[model samples]
Target: MIQPHQHADQACSECTQRLGLIESGLRGVTPVRFNAAGWYRGELRREILRLRLNQDVSVLKAITFALQRTLPAKALLVPIPSWKTQKRANPLPALICRSLGRTTKTLLKRCRPTVGQHHLSRRQRLVNMKSAFAIHPDQQSWCVSATPTWIVDDILTSGATAQEALHTLKRAGLEVRGLICLGRTP
Candidate 1:
Protein backbone atom coordinates (compact mmCIF):
# COMPACT_ATOMS: atom_id res chain seq x y z
CA MET A 1 0.00 0.00 0.00
CA ILE A 2 1.16 3.58 -0.60
CA GLN A 3 1.87 5.12 2.76
CA PRO A 4 0.89 8.74 3.30
CA HIS A 5 3.58 11.05 1.92
CA GLN A 6 2.42 14.43 3.20
CA HIS A 7 4.15 16.06 6.17
CA ALA A 8 4.72 12.89 8.15
CA ASP A 9 3.43 13.89 11.59
CA GLN A 10 0.69 16.09 10.09
CA ALA A 11 -1.61 16.23 7.09
CA CYS A 12 -2.91 19.21 5.20
CA SER A 13 -6.66 19.39 5.63
CA GLU A 14 -7.23 20.21 1.99
CA CYS A 15 -5.22 17.19 0.90
CA THR A 16 -7.17 14.89 3.16
CA GLN A 17 -10.49 16.32 2.03
CA ARG A 18 -9.55 16.09 -1.62
CA LEU A 19 -8.44 12.48 -1.37
CA GLY A 20 -11.65 11.65 0.43
CA LEU A 21 -13.70 13.23 -2.35
CA ILE A 22 -11.84 11.36 -5.05
CA GLU A 23 -12.40 8.03 -3.27
CA SER A 24 -9.79 5.28 -2.71
CA GLY A 25 -7.60 2.71 -4.58
CA LEU A 26 -4.97 5.14 -5.90
CA ARG A 27 -2.42 7.60 -4.46
CA GLY A 28 -1.30 11.22 -4.90
CA VAL A 29 2.15 12.86 -4.90
CA THR A 30 2.66 16.59 -4.57
CA PRO A 31 5.37 18.89 -3.24
CA VAL A 32 4.62 21.52 -0.65
CA ARG A 33 4.45 25.11 -1.81
CA PHE A 34 6.90 27.48 -0.15
CA ASN A 35 4.01 29.54 1.21
CA ALA A 36 6.30 32.53 1.69
CA ALA A 37 6.75 35.89 0.05
CA GLY A 38 8.49 36.94 -3.17
CA TRP A 39 9.85 34.30 -5.54
CA TYR A 40 9.16 31.29 -3.38
CA ARG A 41 5.55 32.27 -2.87
CA GLY A 42 4.86 32.17 -6.59
CA GLU A 43 7.23 29.40 -7.55
CA LEU A 44 4.50 26.93 -8.42
CA ARG A 45 2.60 29.54 -10.39
CA ARG A 46 5.72 30.45 -12.36
CA GLU A 47 6.53 26.82 -12.99
CA ILE A 48 3.03 26.17 -14.27
CA LEU A 49 3.37 28.98 -16.79
CA ARG A 50 6.79 27.70 -17.75
CA LEU A 51 5.44 24.21 -18.34
CA ARG A 52 2.68 25.49 -20.58
CA LEU A 53 5.17 27.41 -22.68
CA ASN A 54 6.81 24.06 -23.63
CA GLN A 55 10.25 25.65 -23.46
CA ASP A 56 11.69 24.02 -20.37
CA VAL A 57 11.96 20.27 -20.66
CA SER A 58 14.77 20.09 -18.10
CA VAL A 59 12.72 21.86 -15.46
CA LEU A 60 9.74 19.65 -16.20
CA LYS A 61 11.96 16.57 -15.84
CA ALA A 62 12.93 17.65 -12.34
CA ILE A 63 9.38 18.49 -11.36
CA THR A 64 8.09 15.23 -12.80
CA PHE A 65 10.65 13.27 -10.82
CA ALA A 66 9.30 14.80 -7.63
CA LEU A 67 5.71 14.09 -8.68
CA GLN A 68 6.26 10.37 -9.41
CA ARG A 69 8.36 9.39 -6.39
CA THR A 70 5.28 8.07 -4.57
CA LEU A 71 3.00 6.92 -7.39
CA PRO A 72 2.51 3.43 -8.77
CA ALA A 73 4.39 2.72 -11.96
CA LYS A 74 1.47 0.99 -13.65
CA ALA A 75 -1.46 3.37 -13.25
CA LEU A 76 -2.61 5.09 -16.40
CA LEU A 77 -2.54 8.90 -16.37
CA VAL A 78 -5.26 11.20 -17.67
CA PRO A 79 -4.37 14.87 -17.81
CA ILE A 80 -7.01 17.57 -17.66
CA PRO A 81 -7.40 19.24 -21.00
CA SER A 82 -6.29 22.80 -21.64
CA TRP A 83 -8.25 25.35 -23.61
CA LYS A 84 -8.02 25.04 -27.39
CA THR A 85 -6.89 28.63 -27.86
CA GLN A 86 -3.66 28.06 -26.00
CA LYS A 87 -0.75 28.66 -28.30
CA ARG A 88 1.37 25.71 -27.17
CA ALA A 89 -1.23 23.70 -25.22
CA ASN A 90 1.34 21.53 -23.43
CA PRO A 91 0.16 20.85 -19.92
CA LEU A 92 2.40 19.92 -17.01
CA PRO A 93 0.23 16.97 -15.99
CA ALA A 94 0.76 15.07 -19.24
CA LEU A 95 4.46 15.94 -19.40
CA ILE A 96 5.03 14.60 -15.90
CA CYS A 97 3.17 11.37 -16.68
CA ARG A 98 5.38 10.91 -19.72
CA SER A 99 8.47 11.53 -17.60
CA LEU A 100 7.38 8.86 -15.12
CA GLY A 101 7.23 6.26 -17.86
CA ARG A 102 3.51 5.89 -17.31
CA THR A 103 1.03 5.14 -20.05
CA THR A 104 -0.47 8.59 -20.49
CA LYS A 105 -3.54 9.65 -22.49
CA THR A 106 -5.12 13.00 -23.15
CA LEU A 107 -8.65 11.68 -23.35
CA LEU A 108 -10.62 14.85 -22.66
CA LYS A 109 -11.12 18.02 -24.66
CA ARG A 110 -12.51 21.33 -23.57
CA CYS A 111 -16.08 21.64 -24.70
CA ARG A 112 -15.80 25.35 -24.01
CA PRO A 113 -13.27 27.58 -22.36
CA THR A 114 -14.23 28.88 -18.95
CA VAL A 115 -13.04 31.95 -17.11
CA GLY A 116 -9.94 31.74 -14.93
CA GLN A 117 -10.35 30.25 -11.47
CA HIS A 118 -8.33 32.85 -9.57
CA HIS A 119 -11.32 34.70 -8.08
CA LEU A 120 -13.88 31.90 -8.02
CA SER A 121 -15.35 30.29 -4.89
CA ARG A 122 -15.72 26.52 -4.61
CA ARG A 123 -19.29 26.33 -5.88
CA GLN A 124 -18.54 28.91 -8.53
CA ARG A 125 -15.61 26.86 -9.73
CA LEU A 126 -17.81 23.80 -10.03
CA VAL A 127 -20.42 25.70 -11.99
CA ASN A 128 -17.87 27.35 -14.23
CA MET A 129 -16.26 24.07 -15.19
CA LYS A 130 -19.49 22.16 -15.65
CA SER A 131 -19.53 20.32 -18.98
CA ALA A 132 -16.16 21.91 -19.70
CA PHE A 133 -14.79 18.59 -20.84
CA ALA A 134 -15.89 16.07 -23.44
CA ILE A 135 -14.31 12.77 -24.40
CA HIS A 136 -13.38 12.81 -28.02
CA PRO A 137 -14.97 9.79 -29.72
CA ASP A 138 -11.65 8.52 -31.00
CA GLN A 139 -10.04 8.84 -27.57
CA GLN A 140 -12.72 6.80 -25.82
CA SER A 141 -10.59 3.66 -25.84
CA TRP A 142 -7.96 5.26 -23.61
CA CYS A 143 -10.34 5.37 -20.68
CA VAL A 144 -11.22 1.65 -20.89
CA SER A 145 -8.91 0.50 -18.18
CA ALA A 146 -8.62 -2.66 -16.10
CA THR A 147 -5.96 -1.06 -13.97
CA PRO A 148 -6.78 1.98 -11.89
CA THR A 149 -6.26 5.33 -13.61
CA TRP A 150 -5.48 8.82 -12.24
CA ILE A 151 -6.66 12.29 -13.21
CA VAL A 152 -3.74 14.68 -12.90
CA ASP A 153 -3.33 18.43 -12.83
CA ASP A 154 -0.72 21.08 -12.04
CA ILE A 155 -2.36 22.27 -8.84
CA LEU A 156 -5.25 21.47 -6.50
CA THR A 157 -6.83 24.49 -4.86
CA SER A 158 -10.62 24.02 -4.63
CA GLY A 159 -10.65 20.63 -6.44
CA ALA A 160 -13.42 21.79 -8.77
CA THR A 161 -11.39 20.94 -11.84
CA ALA A 162 -10.49 17.55 -10.48
CA GLN A 163 -14.08 16.76 -9.56
CA GLU A 164 -15.36 17.82 -12.96
CA ALA A 165 -12.73 15.75 -14.74
CA LEU A 166 -13.49 12.71 -12.63
CA HIS A 167 -17.21 13.01 -13.28
CA THR A 168 -16.65 13.52 -16.99
CA LEU A 169 -14.51 10.38 -17.07
CA LYS A 170 -17.21 8.43 -15.26
CA ARG A 171 -19.73 9.72 -17.77
CA ALA A 172 -17.48 8.25 -20.43
CA GLY A 173 -17.59 4.88 -18.63
CA LEU A 174 -14.26 5.32 -16.83
CA GLU A 175 -13.69 4.35 -13.20
CA VAL A 176 -11.12 6.80 -11.92
CA ARG A 177 -9.15 5.63 -8.92
CA GLY A 178 -7.64 8.89 -7.73
CA LEU A 179 -6.60 12.48 -8.38
CA ILE A 180 -2.95 13.53 -8.46
CA CYS A 181 -1.45 16.98 -8.46
CA LEU A 182 1.93 18.71 -8.46
CA GLY A 183 1.15 21.33 -5.83
CA ARG A 184 -1.46 22.28 -3.23
CA THR A 185 -2.10 25.98 -3.11
CA PRO A 186 -2.24 27.52 0.32
Candidate 2:
Protein backbone atom coordinates (compact mmCIF):
# COMPACT_ATOMS: atom_id res chain seq x y z
CA MET A 1 0.00 0.00 0.00
CA ILE A 2 0.99 3.65 -0.48
CA GLN A 3 1.86 5.86 2.47
CA PRO A 4 0.40 9.37 2.63
CA HIS A 5 3.48 11.25 3.85
CA GLN A 6 5.82 9.23 1.63
CA HIS A 7 7.68 7.87 4.63
CA ALA A 8 11.17 6.49 4.00
CA ASP A 9 11.35 3.72 6.60
CA GLN A 10 11.34 1.01 3.94
CA ALA A 11 14.42 -1.15 3.18
CA CYS A 12 16.54 -0.64 0.11
CA SER A 13 17.32 -4.33 -0.40
CA GLU A 14 14.17 -4.97 -2.42
CA CYS A 15 15.26 -2.67 -5.22
CA THR A 16 18.86 -3.85 -5.01
CA GLN A 17 17.89 -7.46 -5.66
CA ARG A 18 15.75 -6.52 -8.61
CA LEU A 19 18.63 -4.56 -10.12
CA GLY A 20 20.78 -7.66 -9.87
CA LEU A 21 18.37 -9.75 -11.94
CA ILE A 22 19.68 -9.11 -15.46
CA GLU A 23 23.06 -10.82 -15.94
CA SER A 24 24.38 -9.86 -19.32
CA GLY A 25 26.59 -6.94 -20.46
CA LEU A 26 26.96 -4.28 -17.75
CA ARG A 27 25.15 -6.20 -15.03
CA GLY A 28 27.73 -8.99 -14.97
CA VAL A 29 30.53 -6.92 -13.51
CA THR A 30 28.79 -4.53 -11.16
CA PRO A 31 28.08 -4.74 -7.44
CA VAL A 32 24.67 -3.80 -6.04
CA ARG A 33 23.75 -2.92 -2.47
CA PHE A 34 20.85 -1.60 -0.38
CA ASN A 35 21.84 1.87 0.75
CA ALA A 36 21.04 3.16 4.23
CA ALA A 37 18.76 5.86 2.84
CA GLY A 38 16.57 3.16 1.26
CA TRP A 39 18.04 3.38 -2.23
CA TYR A 40 19.80 0.72 -4.27
CA ARG A 41 23.60 1.08 -4.70
CA GLY A 42 25.62 0.14 -7.74
CA GLU A 43 28.81 1.04 -9.58
CA LEU A 44 27.87 3.90 -11.88
CA ARG A 45 31.01 4.00 -13.99
CA ARG A 46 29.77 2.08 -17.02
CA GLU A 47 26.58 0.42 -15.87
CA ILE A 48 24.51 3.56 -15.38
CA LEU A 49 23.39 3.77 -18.99
CA ARG A 50 22.93 0.05 -19.35
CA LEU A 51 20.87 -0.23 -16.15
CA ARG A 52 18.62 2.48 -17.52
CA LEU A 53 18.19 0.54 -20.72
CA ASN A 54 17.62 -2.87 -19.14
CA GLN A 55 15.92 -2.76 -15.74
CA ASP A 56 14.51 0.77 -15.82
CA VAL A 57 11.57 -0.08 -18.09
CA SER A 58 9.95 -2.42 -15.60
CA VAL A 59 10.40 0.08 -12.80
CA LEU A 60 8.93 2.87 -14.92
CA LYS A 61 5.87 0.75 -15.75
CA ALA A 62 5.32 0.26 -12.05
CA ILE A 63 5.58 4.02 -11.37
CA THR A 64 3.17 4.72 -14.21
CA PHE A 65 0.61 2.40 -12.66
CA ALA A 66 0.95 4.04 -9.27
CA LEU A 67 0.61 7.59 -10.63
CA GLN A 68 -2.13 6.95 -13.20
CA ARG A 69 -4.49 5.77 -10.48
CA THR A 70 -3.61 8.51 -8.03
CA LEU A 71 -2.50 11.80 -9.57
CA PRO A 72 -3.92 14.14 -12.15
CA ALA A 73 -2.48 15.42 -15.41
CA LYS A 74 0.26 18.14 -15.48
CA ALA A 75 2.22 16.26 -12.83
CA LEU A 76 5.81 16.77 -13.95
CA LEU A 77 8.36 14.09 -13.03
CA VAL A 78 11.51 15.45 -11.35
CA PRO A 79 14.28 13.02 -10.47
CA ILE A 80 16.76 13.86 -7.72
CA PRO A 81 20.22 13.99 -9.23
CA SER A 82 23.19 12.15 -7.74
CA TRP A 83 26.59 13.65 -6.95
CA LYS A 84 28.85 14.32 -9.98
CA THR A 85 30.27 11.11 -11.48
CA GLN A 86 27.56 9.23 -9.66
CA LYS A 87 25.23 10.19 -12.48
CA ARG A 88 27.42 8.44 -15.04
CA ALA A 89 27.70 5.37 -12.84
CA ASN A 90 24.14 4.56 -11.72
CA PRO A 91 21.66 6.85 -13.41
CA LEU A 92 18.73 4.64 -12.47
CA PRO A 93 16.40 7.39 -11.25
CA ALA A 94 16.89 9.44 -14.39
CA LEU A 95 16.25 6.39 -16.51
CA ILE A 96 13.04 5.52 -14.71
CA CYS A 97 11.82 9.11 -14.87
CA ARG A 98 12.42 9.28 -18.62
CA SER A 99 10.52 6.08 -19.31
CA LEU A 100 7.66 6.87 -16.98
CA GLY A 101 7.45 10.44 -18.26
CA ARG A 102 6.87 9.18 -21.78
CA THR A 103 4.29 6.67 -20.65
CA THR A 104 2.47 9.20 -18.49
CA LYS A 105 2.93 12.06 -20.94
CA THR A 106 4.83 14.12 -18.34
CA LEU A 107 8.12 15.98 -18.36
CA LEU A 108 11.26 14.50 -16.73
CA LYS A 109 14.79 15.82 -16.06
CA ARG A 110 17.51 16.21 -13.43
CA CYS A 111 18.04 19.66 -11.99
CA ARG A 112 20.89 19.37 -9.45
CA PRO A 113 22.66 17.10 -7.00
CA THR A 114 22.43 17.16 -3.23
CA VAL A 115 24.75 15.67 -0.64
CA GLY A 116 24.53 11.88 -0.33
CA GLN A 117 22.28 10.65 2.48
CA HIS A 118 23.66 7.13 2.85
CA HIS A 119 25.04 7.30 6.40
CA LEU A 120 23.38 10.43 7.66
CA SER A 121 20.82 10.56 10.49
CA ARG A 122 17.22 11.50 9.70
CA ARG A 123 17.78 15.15 10.54
CA GLN A 124 21.08 15.11 8.69
CA ARG A 125 19.32 13.52 5.75
CA LEU A 126 16.97 16.47 5.64
CA VAL A 127 19.68 19.08 6.01
CA ASN A 128 22.01 17.44 3.55
CA MET A 129 19.32 17.31 0.89
CA LYS A 130 17.91 20.77 1.36
CA SER A 131 17.84 22.67 -1.95
CA ALA A 132 19.43 19.68 -3.60
CA PHE A 133 17.28 19.48 -6.71
CA ALA A 134 15.53 21.86 -9.08
CA ILE A 135 13.38 21.60 -12.18
CA HIS A 136 15.49 21.86 -15.29
CA PRO A 137 15.61 25.50 -16.40
CA ASP A 138 14.05 24.57 -19.69
CA GLN A 139 11.07 23.14 -17.84
CA GLN A 140 10.81 25.99 -15.34
CA SER A 141 7.85 27.54 -17.11
CA TRP A 142 5.99 24.23 -17.01
CA CYS A 143 6.25 24.11 -13.23
CA VAL A 144 5.61 27.81 -12.56
CA SER A 145 1.83 27.55 -12.47
CA ALA A 146 1.51 25.37 -9.37
CA THR A 147 1.02 22.08 -11.22
CA PRO A 148 1.33 18.77 -9.41
CA THR A 149 4.93 17.56 -9.27
CA TRP A 150 6.28 14.19 -8.20
CA ILE A 151 9.81 13.16 -7.22
CA VAL A 152 10.76 9.72 -8.54
CA ASP A 153 13.45 7.46 -7.19
CA ASP A 154 14.37 3.78 -6.85
CA ILE A 155 14.02 3.40 -3.08
CA LEU A 156 12.53 5.43 -0.21
CA THR A 157 14.89 4.84 2.71
CA SER A 158 14.72 7.55 5.39
CA GLY A 159 12.97 9.70 2.75
CA ALA A 160 15.54 12.45 3.22
CA THR A 161 16.40 12.49 -0.43
CA ALA A 162 12.85 12.75 -1.71
CA GLN A 163 11.99 15.27 0.95
CA GLU A 164 14.81 17.48 -0.22
CA ALA A 165 13.72 17.12 -3.81
CA LEU A 166 10.18 18.04 -2.86
CA HIS A 167 11.44 21.06 -0.98
CA THR A 168 13.62 22.23 -3.83
CA LEU A 169 10.92 21.84 -6.48
CA LYS A 170 8.35 23.50 -4.31
CA ARG A 171 10.73 26.31 -3.46
CA ALA A 172 11.09 26.89 -7.17
CA GLY A 173 7.29 27.27 -7.23
CA LEU A 174 5.97 23.84 -8.20
CA GLU A 175 3.27 22.09 -6.26
CA VAL A 176 4.94 18.89 -5.16
CA ARG A 177 2.19 16.28 -5.22
CA GLY A 178 4.13 13.25 -3.84
CA LEU A 179 6.99 10.80 -4.05
CA ILE A 180 7.12 7.53 -6.05
CA CYS A 181 9.50 4.61 -6.02
CA LEU A 182 9.86 0.99 -7.14
CA GLY A 183 9.74 -0.61 -3.66
CA ARG A 184 9.46 0.27 0.02
CA THR A 185 11.26 -1.28 3.03
CA PRO A 186 8.20 -1.88 5.19
Models, CA RMSD each: 9.3, 11.3
**lDDT tens string, model 2, 1-186?**
111223332213344334332211111101111121222344221233344556545434433343333445556666656666753545666665665543231233335555656678878877776665555666656657665666666666677676666666667777676675543333
Candidate 1: residue pairs that collide: none
Worst 10 residues of 1 by lDDT: 32-41
Per-residue lDDT tens digits for candidate 1, residues 104-148, read 888878888898888999889989988898987778876666766
lDDT of each: 0.61, 0.49
Cα-based TM-score, every candidate:
0.70, 0.56
How does candidate 1 score on lDDT?
Answer: 0.61
Clashing pairs in 2: 10-185, 11-185, 37-157, 38-157, 44-89, 44-90, 45-89
Judged by whole-model lDDT over C-alpha atoms, candidate 2 comes out at 0.49
Clashes of each: 0, 7
Model 2 ranges off by over 4 Å: 1-53, 56-67, 86-89, 101-115
